[model samples]
Target: MSFNPKDALDAVRDIATNAVEKASDIVENAADIIRGDIKGGTSAIVANSIDIATHAVDRTKEVFTGEDDDED
Candidate 1:
């Protein structure tokens, strides 16, 4: 039973990746509930969903790549 730093870091990265995905789901659902309460808010809700998804993808990429993608 040897301590492997690479394995530890990989495990941590996996956990972080899963967390980010779950958080994004929660935020998207919350936006639905919040926007649903208002009348004629379908467009706003859809836009919010897209925005959250884009951010989640970017964050997940950063987590796996271990760096931020600042390029447009």
Candidate 2:
């Protein structure tokens, strides 16, 4: 298959967006951690962990497909 530069750029864009999301999550979580919103040995920790993973996945899909949760 011929290499398509547009597809390559789109893939890179998705990856970049994912990185940005992760960075934002880190900052937000750090604050939550300090504020005790993300305490250890609690469901808050588990829920936050799941949220981090789900957001990364959802962000990737949105970047690649141009559709968001609102459209679903």
Candidate 3:
């Protein structure tokens, strides 16, 4: 048996490259599925989240200033 460092290095590089490519494909496929699922609900979810956040900020401001903007 002959010990070849170059051959061993080449084999390791090949394995790493293959693993990365497979991982990338898996991630891309998962993203596609998620996009399909969220296609209809994503907009509504985002809108509701924005509204809630805005209301929270407004309430925080009123609490700090002790002034209600609605009375204006």
Candidate 4:
């Protein structure tokens, strides 16, 4: 029996396994980054909407109360 063919096959298998593992890790990291960005963007949009609504309400109240200072 010879030790050359078996050793070569084992080395090739090890290289393929390491490549697959590295690829998996990269994909997982990318997914996490995308998810975080989406969440942050949603929160910012909600906050801006709330601020606009509050300003609109204040303006509405002012319009209703009026500002004529010379009433008899």
Clashes of each: 0, 0, 0, 0
Ranking 2 against 3 by lDDT, winner = 2
Q: TM-score of the candidate numbered 2?
A: 0.45
Q: Per-residue CA lDDT of candidate 4, range 1-72, in tens?
A: 334555455545654565565556555555655778666555555554555555444443434454323353
* Ranking of all predicted structures according to lDDT, beginning with the best and ending with the worst: 2, 1, 3, 4
TM-score between candidate 1 and the true structure: 0.44
Query: Which digits, one per residue and each the tens of the lDDT, describe model 1 over residues 13-43?
Result: 7656665665676566667668664533455
Give the Å error, residue 35, model 3: 13
Clash pairs, model 1 backbone: none
- Per-residue lDDT tens digits of candidate 3, residues 1-72? 354566556545655565565556555555655878555445544554565555555554555555557889
Task: Write down the RMSD of all candidates, one decimal each.
Answer: 7.4, 5.4, 23.2, 31.7
Candidate 4 contains a number of clashing pairs equal to 0
- Candidate 3, run of 10 with poorest lDDT: 39-48
Which residue segments of model 4 deviate by more than 4 Å? 1-3, 36-72
Most TM-score-accurate candidate = 2
**Top model by lDDT, which number?**
2
What is the model-wide C-alpha lDDT for candidate 4?
0.52
